[model samples]
Target: MIATNGDLERGAVDDQVVVRGAVGDDLAGILSVGHRTWLATYEPIAGPEYVAMGLAKWWTSDVVTDAIRKGRTLVAVLGDEVVGVATFGPQDDAVVLWKLYVLPGHHGLGIGSRLMDEVVVQARESGHDRITLSYLEGNEQAARFYARHGFTETHRETPGSGLPESVWMARELGEREQS
Candidate 1:
């Protein structure tokens, strides 16, 4: 938890917010946030049918537990309440951004960016040179977000859930911005 700071709502910060390493107990909250945010953000682009099934298939405590426990799971909290989360680990030869999501009400407040920035830092520290993630092709919102954050389209894919037209994105992590 990073103490709401100016990230969540601005001006009205939640003093108790925390950005911490998630353990098993936090799996449910992370999954809940993922489900809520995905539905809120992707439903418009993914459509009701695909988003609905994606939610049902992906938003499970077990799935989340498996994600977090596999490598590194980080959680964002607003005063004991979860607002966002991300998980990262090696995907074959590259570091993978397993998931990066922010709750609906907290969107556009830089929460997602912050989580991603931290992941990039960790990946760099770990000596990873590349990172990969994917989003629905129709979900231009997410594609733009990732592009703006330094990712580029590398390939198209069929989503694991059988959803059509996913754009696989990647970023070279070794490129460092001048500080």
Candidate 2:
């Protein structure tokens, strides 16, 4: 259950949002963030069935616990509430961003951008050259967000199960988003 804080280091993103690695005490809040964001964002774009499958596969306590224990999960906290979550880890030659989601109500407040910034910082500190992520092809918001963060389309994959295509994207560590 990752009883200790797993050491990705911690910092405040701003006066309102504290960005930190997940601890055992954060399991419930992290799960809540994931469930809420998935329902609010993906249910509309990917359908209820797809949402159900995703929640079952990715939002479980066991999966999140594993991520937290690995020191690869970060949470954005607004006061005492968990408003966002991101999980990433080494994949081949780069870091693969397995998950990144901010609560719907918190969108446009720069929470996700702050999370991405920390991800790039951490990846560079860990000596990675690039980061990779994939979003559902139908999710235009995600597409725009990743593009704004300097990610470009690397490829696409049809997951075949009536699911939307996955639009894979990557960004080199040397690049920075235009502010």
Candidate 3:
């Protein structure tokens, strides 16, 4: 999605959300939304300690800033509030979706879908044939969400980090639709 001031303008039409490239200024907002989403979505399934450890190791401001700098991070905004975030980048020879999170309060608003659409568009534009991502096994919400978006589980592995088994999923990126 194109980044523009009009996209970030206040009083966005009701239920009208925009997905755009994240900027360095969005690090704190991204971190906050990510942490809140993780706590609400994963804390119960993985426990607070594991969630804390993962967040501390992965959601640092520096990491988010670097991703933004690389143009691999996208943020979903409604009015001036950030409701979701998606991050993806090249891994080996393919694009790997590293993170896709939406605030709990914003669930069911199609923010995740919009973010995934942007990710798919980015992957396709980057000349990738497929995009891959992993989710903790037993996360039915995540599994269903990805399945609905055309991703299929290809494999499972134990991360050996006190976390549950991880399920790897991938979706083929076919021809992009002409606008």
Candidate 4:
């Protein structure tokens, strides 16, 4: 039920982006944004084969549907279009950010930052001391973005997918007012 709106004056002038919790009806939009962003962001870094493998393994509608059912999904809407998504939930006693993607065309308009802000808000509200996430090793953009938001690399691993090494990162959370 969490929802908020912000104005993005760049790119699409006067664009108002809304961030809100995902519901059952938002499955299609979530899947669409996730698929498009994944292809656009990872294809260049990992090549077609690796992107396909990872998509098949993780981006299926069923997987997203299940996450929504568990109340662990959020969507950023620009007008009537779903432009960004983030999914997070508890894992091993820490909140794990499973996914965060903003449409390539919507990049740099603060949509991703808005989604991330919501993630931190939720983590703190849920009494989590830390948040964790992993990105492909070569995704320098992701690394820099997370680092700017206080996440620091904790370790690295090569998942069975064999695409590339994964860099795990984490950030400690403190009580703060939601923005």
Candidate 5:
């Protein structure tokens, strides 16, 4: 097997819901939460097979570490347990939100929006003109969520090779969301 290029030791996680330093440790749990969140968010659009395969590759400890080290990743916690994870990173001159996930039970509680709010605030503070993210086009709920948060469909992207394709969304950070 080829060795992963992820630098597992280069990340430091902070607690978003309470204390700080909630990045590593018990990676299995974090991955489990990631899997659950993926299922909840992607199952309706990408199907279970895609979600499963993606989880297998994306939820690994190494991948998570690489993301935290390279991106702005925030972990949501209630006490000592992490219930969610969100990441923002530079992608092609825009700040892309790579991950914004919460456990199934944590949904509908504004947790996802809270995470997005934090990301938007940070991106704006960092002088990002816009933020972008992609989601399977078939996922209407997710599309609605992004729309509610002021993201507009900017383009469509296809990975080909049976990979799930998605719509790219962009929101201008300098503009305020209209009420």
Candidate 6:
């Protein structure tokens, strides 16, 4: 439902990227973004084994399809390419952002922020009081990005696999908007 496109100044030509709900057709692009970003972002920080474990476990057709079918996944597309992705849904008392990643080449281009803004809007519209997410401890980029979006660290959990601890963060939704 968060279908919106913005023209960003890139070199001399404008690039239009749209952020919208993911569909079954988006499975491949979603997987690609997840795989590329996972490799580029985590392979160094968490080691190749850790990155391999994640790719094997998370970046699968079945998982991405389920998220899309649930109507909780969003994808940022430039023309026909999936440049970024985010998926979230109810987790206990709050809406937990299960995943959010942008292609490394697309970083700092506001695509992630646009996806996040839509997530916050959707969460608020759904009557949620807060949005929670977790990032690997050493992913400073993620930590700073989420913090910039007003999320504060709540706790950390050790998943135990020679992997870094997952740092949980949350941002209060304040009040729900009247429909």
What does candidate 5's lDDT look like per residue over 1-179, in tens digits?
A: 21122411112222234322235573665687898788887777667888888888888888887766654777666555676778788766679998777777655556667678778777877778899998886777678888998999988989786666788999988777542
lDDT tens string, model 6, 45-64?
89999989888888889888
TM-score of 2: 0.90
> Can you give the TM-score per candidate against the true fold?
0.81, 0.90, 0.87, 0.87, 0.78, 0.88
Candidate 6 segments whose C-alpha is farther than 4 A from its true place: 1-15, 175-179
Count backbone overlaps in model 5. 1
Per-residue C-alpha lDDT of model 1 across residues 47-76, encoded as one tens digit per residue: 688768777787777777787676588887
Candidate 4: lDDT over CA atoms?
Answer: 0.82
Question: Residues 98-156, candidate 4, lDDT per residue (tens digit)?
Answer: 99998777677778888899988888788888999999988888888888888889999
Kindly report which residue stretches of model 5 are placed more than 4 angstroms away from their true locations once superposed.
1-22, 160-164, 177-179
Q: Pick the candidate with the highest TM-score.
A: 2
lDDT (Cα) of model 2: 0.86
- The TM-score of candidate 4 is 0.87
What residue pairs clash in candidate 5, if any at all?
A: 13-23
CA RMSD of each candidate after superposition:
3.8, 6.7, 5.4, 4.6, 9.5, 5.0
Candidate 2, residue 75: lDDT: 92
Score each candidate by Cα lDDT: 0.75, 0.86, 0.83, 0.82, 0.71, 0.85
